[model samples]
Target: MSADAFIAAGPRPPRAGAVATTATYAWRGLLKVRHVPEQLIDVTIGPILLLVMFTYVFGGAISGTTGDYLQFLLPGILVMGVLLTSVASGVILQADRAAGVVDRFRSLPSWRAAPLVGAVVADSVRYLATAAVILVTGLLLGFDAGGGLLGVLAAALLVTVFAFALSWLFTTLGLVVRGASAVQGIGMMAIFLLVFVSNVFVDPATLPAAVAAFVDVNPVSHLVTAVRTLLAGDPAGADVALALAEAAAVTAVFAPLTARLYGRP
Candidate 1:
Protein backbone atom coordinates (compact mmCIF):
# COMPACT_ATOMS: atom_id res chain seq x y z
CA MET A 1 0.00 0.00 0.00
CA SER A 2 1.10 3.54 -0.75
CA ALA A 3 2.08 5.77 2.15
CA ASP A 4 -1.02 7.92 1.53
CA ALA A 5 -3.25 4.87 1.47
CA PHE A 6 -1.71 3.56 4.67
CA ILE A 7 -2.20 6.95 6.31
CA ALA A 8 -5.83 6.93 5.23
CA ALA A 9 -6.43 3.40 6.52
CA GLY A 10 -8.59 4.95 9.27
CA PRO A 11 -7.80 5.45 12.91
CA ARG A 12 -5.38 3.06 14.53
CA PRO A 13 -6.85 0.47 16.80
CA PRO A 14 -8.10 1.90 20.03
CA ARG A 15 -5.56 2.32 22.77
CA ALA A 16 -5.17 -0.68 25.04
CA GLY A 17 -7.20 -0.85 28.23
CA ALA A 18 -5.50 -0.34 31.53
CA VAL A 19 -5.41 -4.05 32.25
CA ALA A 20 -4.04 -4.89 28.83
CA THR A 21 -1.33 -2.26 28.94
CA THR A 22 -0.36 -3.14 32.45
CA ALA A 23 -0.20 -6.82 31.64
CA THR A 24 1.93 -6.16 28.57
CA TYR A 25 4.48 -4.25 30.59
CA ALA A 26 4.34 -6.91 33.24
CA TRP A 27 5.17 -9.51 30.62
CA ARG A 28 8.04 -7.35 29.51
CA GLY A 29 9.38 -7.41 33.06
CA LEU A 30 9.13 -11.19 33.14
CA LEU A 31 11.01 -11.40 29.86
CA LYS A 32 13.88 -9.65 31.58
CA VAL A 33 14.00 -12.48 34.11
CA ARG A 34 14.06 -15.10 31.38
CA HIS A 35 17.03 -13.44 29.72
CA VAL A 36 18.87 -12.86 32.99
CA PRO A 37 18.15 -15.85 35.16
CA GLU A 38 20.55 -14.57 37.80
CA GLN A 39 17.81 -12.21 38.86
CA LEU A 40 16.26 -15.22 40.55
CA ILE A 41 19.04 -15.42 43.14
CA ASP A 42 17.60 -12.87 45.52
CA VAL A 43 14.18 -14.49 45.55
CA THR A 44 15.57 -18.02 45.77
CA ILE A 45 19.05 -18.44 47.26
CA GLY A 46 18.87 -15.44 49.56
CA PRO A 47 15.70 -16.48 51.32
CA ILE A 48 16.64 -20.14 51.63
CA LEU A 49 19.98 -19.31 53.18
CA LEU A 50 18.32 -16.93 55.61
CA LEU A 51 15.78 -19.52 56.74
CA VAL A 52 18.45 -22.18 57.27
CA MET A 53 21.01 -20.01 59.02
CA PHE A 54 18.56 -18.31 61.33
CA THR A 55 16.91 -21.59 62.22
CA TYR A 56 20.16 -23.42 63.02
CA VAL A 57 22.41 -20.68 64.38
CA PHE A 58 20.00 -19.11 66.81
CA GLY A 59 17.03 -21.42 66.97
CA GLY A 60 18.15 -23.50 69.94
CA ALA A 61 19.07 -20.58 72.18
CA ILE A 62 15.87 -18.76 71.44
CA SER A 63 13.23 -21.48 71.36
CA GLY A 64 15.03 -24.41 73.06
CA THR A 65 14.60 -26.59 69.97
CA THR A 66 15.17 -26.12 66.30
CA GLY A 67 11.73 -27.51 65.55
CA ASP A 68 9.96 -25.15 67.92
CA TYR A 69 11.92 -22.12 66.73
CA LEU A 70 11.27 -23.11 63.14
CA GLN A 71 7.56 -22.85 63.77
CA PHE A 72 7.87 -19.39 65.31
CA LEU A 73 10.49 -18.26 62.84
CA LEU A 74 9.02 -19.46 59.56
CA PRO A 75 6.25 -16.88 59.39
CA GLY A 76 8.57 -14.04 60.21
CA ILE A 77 11.16 -15.32 57.73
CA LEU A 78 8.49 -15.51 55.06
CA VAL A 79 7.56 -11.92 55.71
CA MET A 80 11.19 -10.82 55.78
CA GLY A 81 12.06 -12.66 52.60
CA VAL A 82 9.21 -11.14 50.63
CA LEU A 83 9.65 -7.73 52.15
CA LEU A 84 13.37 -7.66 51.33
CA THR A 85 12.66 -8.92 47.84
CA SER A 86 10.21 -6.05 47.39
CA VAL A 87 13.16 -3.62 47.38
CA ALA A 88 14.15 -4.87 43.96
CA SER A 89 11.05 -3.24 42.54
CA GLY A 90 12.57 0.16 43.16
CA VAL A 91 16.07 -0.85 42.13
CA ILE A 92 14.74 -2.18 38.85
CA LEU A 93 12.75 0.99 38.28
CA GLN A 94 15.82 3.09 38.91
CA ALA A 95 17.79 0.95 36.49
CA ASP A 96 15.07 1.35 33.88
CA ARG A 97 15.21 5.11 34.32
CA ALA A 98 18.98 5.05 33.84
CA ALA A 99 18.64 2.95 30.69
CA GLY A 100 16.11 5.39 29.19
CA VAL A 101 13.43 2.67 29.16
CA VAL A 102 11.09 4.84 31.13
CA ASP A 103 11.51 7.57 28.52
CA ARG A 104 10.56 5.15 25.77
CA PHE A 105 7.60 4.02 27.85
CA ARG A 106 6.41 7.62 27.95
CA SER A 107 6.13 7.65 24.15
CA LEU A 108 4.00 4.52 24.00
CA PRO A 109 0.23 4.81 23.55
CA SER A 110 -0.73 2.92 26.68
CA TRP A 111 -2.03 3.47 30.16
CA ARG A 112 0.07 6.20 31.76
CA ALA A 113 0.61 4.29 34.97
CA ALA A 114 1.12 0.94 33.35
CA PRO A 115 4.94 0.93 33.45
CA LEU A 116 5.05 1.91 37.07
CA VAL A 117 2.18 -0.24 38.26
CA GLY A 118 3.20 -3.12 36.07
CA ALA A 119 6.70 -3.16 37.50
CA VAL A 120 5.28 -3.71 40.95
CA VAL A 121 2.84 -6.32 39.65
CA ALA A 122 5.63 -8.18 37.93
CA ASP A 123 7.67 -8.09 41.12
CA SER A 124 4.84 -9.98 42.73
CA VAL A 125 6.19 -13.08 41.08
CA ARG A 126 9.43 -12.59 42.96
CA TYR A 127 7.44 -12.16 46.14
CA LEU A 128 5.61 -15.41 45.50
CA ALA A 129 8.88 -17.15 44.68
CA THR A 130 10.42 -15.97 47.90
CA ALA A 131 7.43 -17.18 49.88
CA ALA A 132 7.49 -20.57 48.19
CA VAL A 133 11.17 -21.18 48.87
CA ILE A 134 10.78 -20.26 52.51
CA LEU A 135 7.69 -22.43 52.96
CA VAL A 136 9.25 -25.45 51.29
CA THR A 137 12.46 -25.16 53.26
CA GLY A 138 10.56 -24.68 56.48
CA LEU A 139 8.53 -27.78 55.80
CA LEU A 140 11.69 -29.72 55.07
CA LEU A 141 13.01 -28.61 58.40
CA GLY A 142 9.88 -30.00 60.08
CA PHE A 143 8.11 -26.70 60.48
CA ASP A 144 4.50 -27.79 60.73
CA ALA A 145 1.79 -25.51 59.47
CA GLY A 146 -0.74 -25.91 62.23
CA GLY A 147 -3.17 -23.81 60.25
CA GLY A 148 -3.08 -26.33 57.33
CA LEU A 149 -2.78 -25.69 53.63
CA LEU A 150 -5.65 -23.23 53.49
CA GLY A 151 -4.06 -21.19 56.22
CA VAL A 152 -0.74 -21.31 54.42
CA LEU A 153 -2.36 -19.97 51.27
CA ALA A 154 -4.07 -17.21 53.22
CA ALA A 155 -0.80 -16.19 54.82
CA ALA A 156 0.86 -16.06 51.42
CA LEU A 157 -1.95 -13.86 50.11
CA LEU A 158 -1.64 -11.50 53.03
CA VAL A 159 2.14 -11.22 52.66
CA THR A 160 1.78 -10.57 48.94
CA VAL A 161 -0.74 -7.83 49.58
CA PHE A 162 1.54 -6.21 52.11
CA ALA A 163 4.52 -6.56 49.78
CA PHE A 164 2.51 -5.06 46.91
CA ALA A 165 1.64 -2.03 49.01
CA LEU A 166 5.23 -1.61 50.19
CA SER A 167 6.40 -1.85 46.57
CA TRP A 168 4.68 1.46 45.85
CA LEU A 169 6.48 3.13 48.69
CA PHE A 170 9.77 1.89 47.27
CA THR A 171 8.65 2.94 43.79
CA THR A 172 8.36 6.46 45.09
CA LEU A 173 11.83 6.16 46.56
CA GLY A 174 13.15 4.96 43.23
CA LEU A 175 11.95 8.11 41.54
CA VAL A 176 13.37 10.37 44.22
CA VAL A 177 16.74 8.64 44.38
CA ARG A 178 19.34 9.31 41.72
CA GLY A 179 20.92 5.90 41.18
CA ALA A 180 19.90 2.26 41.40
CA SER A 181 22.63 1.54 43.94
CA ALA A 182 21.52 4.47 46.04
CA VAL A 183 17.97 3.25 45.98
CA GLN A 184 19.05 -0.25 46.94
CA GLY A 185 21.28 0.98 49.74
CA ILE A 186 18.65 3.24 51.23
CA GLY A 187 15.83 0.78 50.69
CA MET A 188 17.68 -2.16 52.22
CA MET A 189 18.75 -0.12 55.21
CA ALA A 190 15.21 0.93 55.89
CA ILE A 191 13.96 -2.62 55.48
CA PHE A 192 16.62 -3.98 57.83
CA LEU A 193 15.62 -1.50 60.50
CA LEU A 194 11.96 -2.31 60.12
CA VAL A 195 12.53 -6.06 60.30
CA PHE A 196 14.95 -6.02 63.20
CA VAL A 197 12.94 -3.59 65.28
CA SER A 198 9.75 -5.56 64.84
CA ASN A 199 8.82 -8.96 66.33
CA VAL A 200 10.51 -10.94 63.60
CA PHE A 201 13.43 -12.61 65.41
CA VAL A 202 12.45 -11.84 69.02
CA ASP A 203 9.45 -11.02 71.11
CA PRO A 204 8.57 -7.36 71.53
CA ALA A 205 8.02 -8.04 75.22
CA THR A 206 11.77 -8.52 75.52
CA LEU A 207 12.51 -5.18 73.89
CA PRO A 208 12.98 -1.89 75.64
CA ALA A 209 9.74 -0.21 76.66
CA ALA A 210 9.95 2.49 74.00
CA VAL A 211 11.03 0.01 71.34
CA ALA A 212 8.24 -2.37 72.24
CA ALA A 213 5.78 0.47 71.89
CA PHE A 214 7.03 1.03 68.34
CA VAL A 215 6.97 -2.67 67.53
CA ASP A 216 3.35 -2.84 68.72
CA VAL A 217 2.40 -0.42 65.95
CA ASN A 218 4.92 -1.46 63.34
CA PRO A 219 3.05 -2.63 60.28
CA VAL A 220 5.67 -5.34 59.83
CA SER A 221 4.80 -6.72 63.26
CA HIS A 222 1.14 -6.69 62.39
CA LEU A 223 1.84 -8.48 59.10
CA VAL A 224 4.06 -11.08 60.76
CA THR A 225 1.48 -11.67 63.48
CA ALA A 226 -1.24 -12.10 60.90
CA VAL A 227 0.87 -14.67 59.06
CA ARG A 228 1.65 -16.48 62.31
CA THR A 229 -2.03 -16.57 63.25
CA LEU A 230 -2.95 -18.06 59.92
CA LEU A 231 -0.15 -20.63 60.10
CA ALA A 232 -1.03 -21.53 63.69
CA GLY A 233 -4.60 -22.48 62.78
CA ASP A 234 -5.91 -19.71 64.99
CA PRO A 235 -8.89 -17.55 64.23
CA ALA A 236 -8.13 -14.43 62.30
CA GLY A 237 -7.37 -11.71 64.76
CA ALA A 238 -7.33 -7.89 64.82
CA ASP A 239 -3.78 -8.11 63.43
CA VAL A 240 -5.20 -9.45 60.18
CA ALA A 241 -7.50 -6.47 59.86
CA LEU A 242 -4.73 -4.10 60.84
CA ALA A 243 -2.36 -5.58 58.27
CA LEU A 244 -4.84 -5.17 55.43
CA ALA A 245 -5.69 -1.66 56.56
CA GLU A 246 -2.03 -0.73 56.69
CA ALA A 247 -1.42 -2.15 53.24
CA ALA A 248 -4.37 -0.19 51.86
CA ALA A 249 -3.14 2.97 53.54
CA VAL A 250 0.35 2.57 52.06
CA THR A 251 -0.95 2.00 48.55
CA ALA A 252 -3.28 4.96 48.89
CA VAL A 253 -0.43 7.25 49.83
CA PHE A 254 2.42 6.12 47.57
CA ALA A 255 0.72 4.89 44.39
CA PRO A 256 -0.38 8.38 43.45
CA LEU A 257 2.93 9.88 44.44
CA THR A 258 4.68 7.34 42.25
CA ALA A 259 2.34 8.18 39.37
CA ARG A 260 2.95 11.87 39.86
CA LEU A 261 6.72 11.62 39.79
CA TYR A 262 6.99 8.82 37.24
CA GLY A 263 8.02 10.53 34.02
CA ARG A 264 9.80 13.55 35.36
CA PRO A 265 13.43 14.10 34.41
Candidate 2:
Protein backbone atom coordinates (compact mmCIF):
# COMPACT_ATOMS: atom_id res chain seq x y z
CA MET A 1 0.00 0.00 0.00
CA SER A 2 1.05 3.59 -0.60
CA ALA A 3 2.42 5.74 2.20
CA ASP A 4 -0.53 8.08 1.82
CA ALA A 5 -2.90 5.22 2.41
CA PHE A 6 -0.74 3.82 5.17
CA ILE A 7 -0.86 7.14 6.99
CA ALA A 8 -3.88 9.11 5.87
CA ALA A 9 -3.89 12.54 7.45
CA GLY A 10 -7.29 13.22 8.90
CA PRO A 11 -8.20 13.84 12.51
CA ARG A 12 -5.39 14.11 15.01
CA PRO A 13 -4.40 10.60 15.96
CA PRO A 14 -5.17 9.42 19.44
CA ARG A 15 -2.19 9.51 21.80
CA ALA A 16 -2.21 5.73 22.01
CA GLY A 17 -1.84 5.59 18.22
CA ALA A 18 1.69 6.94 18.69
CA VAL A 19 2.86 3.41 19.47
CA ALA A 20 1.62 2.10 16.11
CA THR A 21 3.03 5.09 14.26
CA THR A 22 6.42 4.72 15.93
CA ALA A 23 6.41 0.99 15.17
CA THR A 24 5.70 1.70 11.49
CA TYR A 25 8.57 4.13 11.25
CA ALA A 26 10.84 1.72 13.10
CA TRP A 27 9.91 -0.99 10.63
CA ARG A 28 10.75 1.35 7.78
CA GLY A 29 14.19 1.95 9.22
CA LEU A 30 14.75 -1.78 9.60
CA LEU A 31 13.65 -2.32 5.99
CA LYS A 32 16.33 0.13 4.87
CA VAL A 33 18.90 -2.03 6.66
CA ARG A 34 17.59 -5.12 4.90
CA HIS A 35 17.79 -3.48 1.47
CA VAL A 36 21.14 -1.78 1.94
CA PRO A 37 23.23 -4.44 3.55
CA GLU A 38 26.24 -2.29 2.76
CA GLN A 39 25.19 -0.21 5.70
CA LEU A 40 26.24 -3.14 7.87
CA ILE A 41 29.87 -2.86 6.79
CA ASP A 42 30.98 -0.40 9.46
CA VAL A 43 29.32 -2.28 12.28
CA THR A 44 30.69 -5.64 11.16
CA ILE A 45 34.12 -4.78 9.77
CA GLY A 46 35.11 -2.13 12.30
CA PRO A 47 34.75 -4.30 15.38
CA ILE A 48 36.48 -7.27 13.81
CA LEU A 49 39.40 -5.21 12.58
CA LEU A 50 39.77 -3.31 15.83
CA LEU A 51 39.51 -6.48 17.88
CA VAL A 52 42.05 -8.37 15.77
CA MET A 53 44.52 -5.63 15.03
CA PHE A 54 44.47 -4.14 18.49
CA THR A 55 44.67 -7.47 20.31
CA TYR A 56 47.39 -8.93 18.12
CA VAL A 57 49.30 -5.99 16.70
CA PHE A 58 49.35 -3.37 19.41
CA GLY A 59 48.26 -5.49 22.32
CA GLY A 60 51.70 -6.92 23.10
CA ALA A 61 53.44 -3.56 22.80
CA ILE A 62 50.95 -1.88 25.08
CA SER A 63 50.48 -4.58 27.68
CA GLY A 64 53.71 -6.66 27.44
CA THR A 65 51.83 -9.73 26.17
CA THR A 66 49.03 -10.48 23.71
CA GLY A 67 47.22 -12.74 26.18
CA ASP A 68 47.02 -10.26 29.02
CA TYR A 69 46.10 -7.42 26.68
CA LEU A 70 43.29 -9.37 25.07
CA GLN A 71 41.59 -9.72 28.41
CA PHE A 72 41.89 -6.00 29.12
CA LEU A 73 41.19 -4.85 25.56
CA LEU A 74 38.13 -6.93 24.78
CA PRO A 75 35.88 -4.98 27.09
CA GLY A 76 37.03 -1.69 25.62
CA ILE A 77 36.53 -3.04 22.12
CA LEU A 78 32.95 -3.88 22.96
CA VAL A 79 32.40 -0.34 24.20
CA MET A 80 34.19 0.96 21.11
CA GLY A 81 31.89 -1.00 18.85
CA VAL A 82 28.83 0.38 20.57
CA LEU A 83 30.16 3.96 20.55
CA LEU A 84 31.01 3.78 16.87
CA THR A 85 27.55 2.53 15.97
CA SER A 86 25.81 5.28 17.97
CA VAL A 87 26.42 7.60 15.04
CA ALA A 88 24.17 5.47 12.87
CA SER A 89 21.07 7.05 14.35
CA GLY A 90 22.20 10.56 13.50
CA VAL A 91 23.52 9.70 10.06
CA ILE A 92 20.29 7.94 9.14
CA LEU A 93 18.21 10.83 10.46
CA GLN A 94 20.25 13.38 8.55
CA ALA A 95 19.94 11.39 5.31
CA ASP A 96 16.20 11.06 5.74
CA ARG A 97 15.93 14.77 6.43
CA ALA A 98 18.03 15.72 3.41
CA ALA A 99 15.92 13.49 1.19
CA GLY A 100 12.75 15.17 2.52
CA VAL A 101 11.67 11.92 4.15
CA VAL A 102 11.31 13.59 7.52
CA ASP A 103 9.40 16.48 5.97
CA ARG A 104 6.98 14.05 4.41
CA PHE A 105 6.49 12.33 7.75
CA ARG A 106 5.96 15.66 9.48
CA SER A 107 2.98 16.25 7.25
CA LEU A 108 1.23 13.20 8.56
CA PRO A 109 -1.12 13.33 11.55
CA SER A 110 0.93 10.75 13.42
CA TRP A 111 2.74 11.38 16.65
CA ARG A 112 5.32 14.12 16.50
CA ALA A 113 7.87 12.00 18.35
CA ALA A 114 7.50 8.97 16.13
CA PRO A 115 10.12 9.71 13.52
CA LEU A 116 13.02 10.51 15.85
CA VAL A 117 12.10 7.86 18.39
CA GLY A 118 11.72 5.17 15.75
CA ALA A 119 14.95 6.07 14.01
CA VAL A 120 16.96 5.91 17.25
CA VAL A 121 15.24 2.71 18.31
CA ALA A 122 16.20 1.16 14.99
CA ASP A 123 19.82 2.11 15.70
CA SER A 124 19.71 -0.10 18.79
CA VAL A 125 19.60 -2.99 16.32
CA ARG A 126 22.88 -1.83 14.82
CA TYR A 127 24.36 -1.40 18.29
CA LEU A 128 23.44 -4.97 19.17
CA ALA A 129 24.94 -6.40 15.98
CA THR A 130 28.24 -4.58 16.53
CA ALA A 131 28.34 -5.70 20.14
CA ALA A 132 27.88 -9.30 19.03
CA VAL A 133 30.71 -9.04 16.52
CA ILE A 134 33.01 -7.64 19.18
CA LEU A 135 32.05 -10.34 21.67
CA VAL A 136 32.57 -13.23 19.26
CA THR A 137 35.83 -11.82 17.96
CA GLY A 138 37.12 -11.31 21.48
CA LEU A 139 36.27 -14.89 22.41
CA LEU A 140 37.95 -16.35 19.33
CA LEU A 141 41.04 -14.28 20.04
CA GLY A 142 41.34 -16.03 23.45
CA PHE A 143 39.85 -13.22 25.49
CA ASP A 144 38.04 -14.84 28.33
CA ALA A 145 35.46 -13.00 30.34
CA GLY A 146 36.21 -13.68 33.97
CA GLY A 147 32.56 -13.14 34.82
CA GLY A 148 31.52 -15.79 32.26
CA LEU A 149 28.44 -15.82 30.03
CA LEU A 150 26.12 -13.87 32.25
CA GLY A 151 28.69 -11.11 32.83
CA VAL A 152 29.40 -10.78 29.12
CA LEU A 153 25.74 -10.57 28.22
CA ALA A 154 25.11 -8.05 30.96
CA ALA A 155 28.02 -5.93 29.75
CA ALA A 156 26.68 -6.01 26.18
CA LEU A 157 23.25 -4.88 27.35
CA LEU A 158 24.78 -2.09 29.40
CA VAL A 159 26.80 -0.84 26.46
CA THR A 160 23.74 -0.98 24.24
CA VAL A 161 21.76 1.08 26.72
CA PHE A 162 24.55 3.63 26.86
CA ALA A 163 24.75 3.64 23.06
CA PHE A 164 21.00 4.14 22.86
CA ALA A 165 21.33 7.22 25.04
CA LEU A 166 24.28 8.60 23.07
CA SER A 167 22.27 8.19 19.86
CA TRP A 168 20.08 11.07 20.95
CA LEU A 169 23.15 13.30 21.15
CA PHE A 170 24.14 12.48 17.60
CA THR A 171 20.57 12.73 16.41
CA THR A 172 20.49 16.26 17.76
CA LEU A 173 23.81 16.96 16.06
CA GLY A 174 22.37 15.68 12.78
CA LEU A 175 19.48 18.09 13.05
CA VAL A 176 21.95 20.90 13.69
CA VAL A 177 24.28 19.95 10.83
CA ARG A 178 23.73 20.73 7.15
CA GLY A 179 24.38 17.36 5.47
CA ALA A 180 24.73 13.69 6.12
CA SER A 181 28.48 13.64 5.51
CA ALA A 182 28.97 16.51 7.92
CA VAL A 183 26.85 14.66 10.46
CA GLN A 184 28.99 11.56 10.14
CA GLY A 185 32.21 13.54 10.36
CA ILE A 186 31.11 15.47 13.39
CA GLY A 187 29.87 12.30 15.05
CA MET A 188 33.15 10.48 14.44
CA MET A 189 35.20 13.35 15.78
CA ALA A 190 33.16 13.34 18.92
CA ILE A 191 33.52 9.58 19.29
CA PHE A 192 37.24 9.75 18.63
CA LEU A 193 37.77 12.39 21.26
CA LEU A 194 35.81 10.46 23.83
CA VAL A 195 37.46 7.12 23.14
CA PHE A 196 41.09 8.16 22.74
CA VAL A 197 41.03 10.43 25.74
CA SER A 198 39.48 7.73 27.88
CA ASN A 199 40.80 4.57 29.51
CA VAL A 200 39.65 2.50 26.57
CA PHE A 201 43.12 1.86 25.18
CA VAL A 202 45.49 2.61 28.05
CA ASP A 203 45.72 2.97 31.76
CA PRO A 204 44.65 6.42 32.85
CA ALA A 205 47.28 6.45 35.58
CA THR A 206 50.06 6.04 33.06
CA LEU A 207 49.14 9.39 31.56
CA PRO A 208 50.16 12.80 32.88
CA ALA A 209 48.40 13.84 36.05
CA ALA A 210 46.26 16.49 34.29
CA VAL A 211 45.14 14.19 31.44
CA ALA A 212 44.57 11.39 33.91
CA ALA A 213 42.06 13.49 35.84
CA PHE A 214 39.97 14.02 32.74
CA VAL A 215 40.13 10.31 31.98
CA ASP A 216 38.88 9.67 35.46
CA VAL A 217 35.97 12.00 34.78
CA ASN A 218 35.27 10.94 31.20
CA PRO A 219 32.02 9.05 30.87
CA VAL A 220 33.39 6.71 28.23
CA SER A 221 36.19 5.68 30.56
CA HIS A 222 33.67 5.03 33.27
CA LEU A 223 31.72 2.82 30.89
CA VAL A 224 34.80 0.85 29.84
CA THR A 225 35.76 0.48 33.45
CA ALA A 226 32.31 -0.84 34.25
CA VAL A 227 32.60 -3.43 31.49
CA ARG A 228 36.06 -4.43 32.71
CA THR A 229 34.89 -4.68 36.28
CA LEU A 230 31.89 -6.76 35.30
CA LEU A 231 33.88 -9.11 33.10
CA ALA A 232 36.41 -9.56 35.91
CA GLY A 233 33.60 -10.68 38.23
CA ASP A 234 34.53 -7.82 40.53
CA PRO A 235 32.15 -5.30 42.02
CA ALA A 236 31.48 -2.57 39.47
CA GLY A 237 30.91 -0.14 42.37
CA ALA A 238 31.32 3.48 41.33
CA ASP A 239 32.10 2.82 37.67
CA VAL A 240 28.68 1.35 36.97
CA ALA A 241 26.99 4.15 38.86
CA LEU A 242 28.93 6.81 37.01
CA ALA A 243 28.34 5.18 33.63
CA LEU A 244 24.60 4.95 34.20
CA ALA A 245 24.40 8.50 35.47
CA GLU A 246 26.18 9.75 32.40
CA ALA A 247 23.81 7.82 30.14
CA ALA A 248 20.78 9.25 31.87
CA ALA A 249 22.17 12.78 31.73
CA VAL A 250 22.96 12.48 28.03
CA THR A 251 19.54 11.12 27.13
CA ALA A 252 17.73 13.66 29.26
CA VAL A 253 19.56 16.54 27.62
CA PHE A 254 19.55 15.42 24.00
CA ALA A 255 16.18 13.71 23.63
CA PRO A 256 14.33 16.96 24.29
CA LEU A 257 16.78 18.95 22.20
CA THR A 258 16.50 16.64 19.19
CA ALA A 259 12.72 16.51 19.45
CA ARG A 260 12.47 20.29 19.60
CA LEU A 261 14.91 20.94 16.78
CA TYR A 262 13.38 18.29 14.54
CA GLY A 263 9.91 19.64 15.20
CA ARG A 264 10.94 23.12 14.12
CA PRO A 265 9.76 24.34 10.73
Q: What is the C-alpha lDDT of each candidate?
A: 0.92, 0.89
Q: Which has the greatest TM-score? A: 1
Candidate 2: tens digits of C-alpha lDDT, residues 1-265: 7878767755655564888888888888899989999999989997899888888899789999999999888898899888989997888888889899889989988899998898888889898899988998888878878888988888988999999999999999889999989999999998999899998888887999999998888889989999999888888878788888999999999999999999987
Q: What digit string (tens of lDDT, one per residue) describes model 1 on residues 35-78?
A: 99999999999999999999999999998998888988999999
Provide the lDDT at 86 for model 2.
Answer: 93
TM-score for each candidate, following the candidate numbering? 0.97, 0.93
Which one wins on lDDT?
1
Clash pairs for candidate 2? none
lDDT of 1 at 118: 83
Quality of model 1 by C-alpha lDDT: 0.92
Backbone clashes in each candidate structure, one number apiece? Answer: 0, 0
Which sections of candidate 1 miss by over 4 Å? none
Error of 2 at 5 (Å): 16
